[model samples]
Target: MTDAERIARVQLARTKGVGPLTYSRFLETYGSGLAALEAFPERVRASGRGELKLYPADKVRREFDETDHIGARIILSGDEDYPELLGHLSPAPPVITVWGNTDLLKKPCVALVGARNASAAAMRIAHDMAHDLGNGGYTVVSGLARGVDTASHNGSLSTGTVAVIAGGIDNIYPAQNEKLRDQIKDTGLVVSESPFGHEPRANDFPRRNRLITGLSLGVVVIEAAQRSGSLISARTALEQGREVMAVPGSPLDNRTRGSNGLIRSGAILVENAEQVIEAIAPAAPSQASLFEMPDDDLDDETLEFSEEDRARIIQALSPTATTIADISLATGIPSRKCAILLVELELEGIAGSLPGGLVRRQN
Candidate 1:
């Protein structure tokens, strides 16, 4: 990518209301980030979405300058050095800022994620499992939270580990983890999709978890409650078609509820690193084939939507999430048209897109 295109990509990615899914579709339709930026506003207006608020170019430049000052590198989605497994994500991160060992992202990876306030035994299990998996030739990936996450990073630090953070690449949460974050930055890798200096909000962690699971061949849960973020990661892994494994824990322990439930619902139940390794090995090569985007011969010009069509699509959406196909069926619109409408709706802040092609009303 040229300097101009790279900058344009980041600016496009930072644009308000342009989530990963929309950014990806824009890139696909427009051919390049520069092209997308040039054409997107007119397209938005043409769709009858009054006006789209783009992220300012000045802010994007400042972000890049700050990232350079901190000695980190920004890897765009189509960049060669971007993680192979992560690139498989449908709307993979448009930009990821990294500190240290970008090469680790190329190696096969297994993610170890669990409760931030985990039991001692669970943390120990996660640590040992990560060490064994690392020694067995897989880079360990995890959110840099406390308890289980900290243990996993400690165990894999020497072999290879990638810490995916919720905030900016330079913003360290759990302020206590700052030392550990620096340690990983020196020996392993620290990654973030957020712009420089962006502090994480409560909702950002789930988005961060997507990257954790997206970057791995599989995800293993050490301990997680039914509503925890770790379970969120496991589900995202399943949506991405990556293997999901959970360490069986005592049913009485509240922290184990989600993981045990996963085993009951068809996730692989594993006791140790060996079982985790065996389960994911067979799917490693096959999963690669699943990431390829399908060919779409339909022309964008032919898929145009008018204000009435956009209103109908929006009417089909509710606070509850529904698939694009279902929305298409309900609104008497073609699936492709529904999709295009959703992107416009998303850019207008009328709808939100989730993984697995689900869309929900934003309000």
Candidate 2:
């Protein structure tokens, strides 16, 4: 990829309505960032999404400038240095900004996430788990929050740790961890989807949680409320087919309630790092070369649909499943055209086909 392509990928990622899935779909349809950048205006026009606004190339070039100014670089998902585990995730970040040792991503990783306001014991558990995991040649992944998140990063600081911050690498929120954040950049790696200087917001936290699990082979939730961010990360791990492990905390402590609940819901109940390492040992050696992308054949230009066919299909699409007959009738398009369009959408990772002749957009 050229510098121009990198700038275009970043621009599309920063664009309105051009999410990871949409950007990827556009790339597939256009075959290159240059082509995608050129085709986007008309693509949105046909889809009736006039509000779609891609970040101007000049502005995104400035973003690259800012990244370089901060001693960071953008890692495209298709790039060799991009985390392979994360690259395979559904609608993964199109591009991630990074600081420090990207080499640490090669080691096996385990995520430790928990309540931001966890108890003393929870902090200790995170610390111990991270320390031992680091000693076992594993990189500990976490958000650098106040309680357990902070403890996890702190403990693994000496060995190896990857801080997947909710905000940009330069904009350290929860200001108290600013120093620790600096230490992480020096020792390990810091990553974020947001451009540099962008502050962390509540909305961005969920996306950040997914990256925590995306980087790890397993996620360990120490202390979380029944519906906390930690559980969200753990759930993402389950979604990504990564192992879900949680420490059994006391039911009485509200902070531990979510992890305990997860334990009951079939997550691995682990007390020490030995359990974590032993559980992962069998698969680790075999999958050591995981950073390599599996599909060398996947290239753009695979998405080709006539405007009439695309319109007919979109008109038929709804939140609920629709049969062939229903789709044909609703779109006023032929059966063959509808089927072909749906296949194209599915291949582009835009939609999923369900059983009994149904289709719906994937989240």
Who wins the TM-score comparison?
Answer: 1
Query: Candidates' lDDT values, in order?
Result: 0.85, 0.77
Per-prediction TM-score to the true structure, in the order listed: 0.88, 0.84
Against the hidden true structure, what lDDT does model 2 obtain? 0.77
Residues 185-263 of candidate 1: C-alpha lDDT, one tens digit per residue: 9999999989899999988888899999988889999999999998889988898998999999999999999999999
Q: Which stretches of candidate 2 lie over 4 Å from their true place?
A: 282-308, 315-363
Query: What are the per-residue Cα lDDT tens digits for candidate 2 across 236-325?
Result: 777677888889987788888889999999998999999998766654321232111122232334534577778567666767866555
Residue pairs with colliding backbones in model 2 are none
Task: Give the clash count for model 2.
Answer: 0
Q: In model 1, which regions exceed 4 Å deviation?
A: 47-51, 286-341, 349-351, 357-363
TM-score of predicted structure 1: 0.88
Residue 127 C-alpha lDDT in model 1: 90
| Candidates' RMSD to native | 3.1, 5.6
So what's the TM-score on candidate 2? 0.84
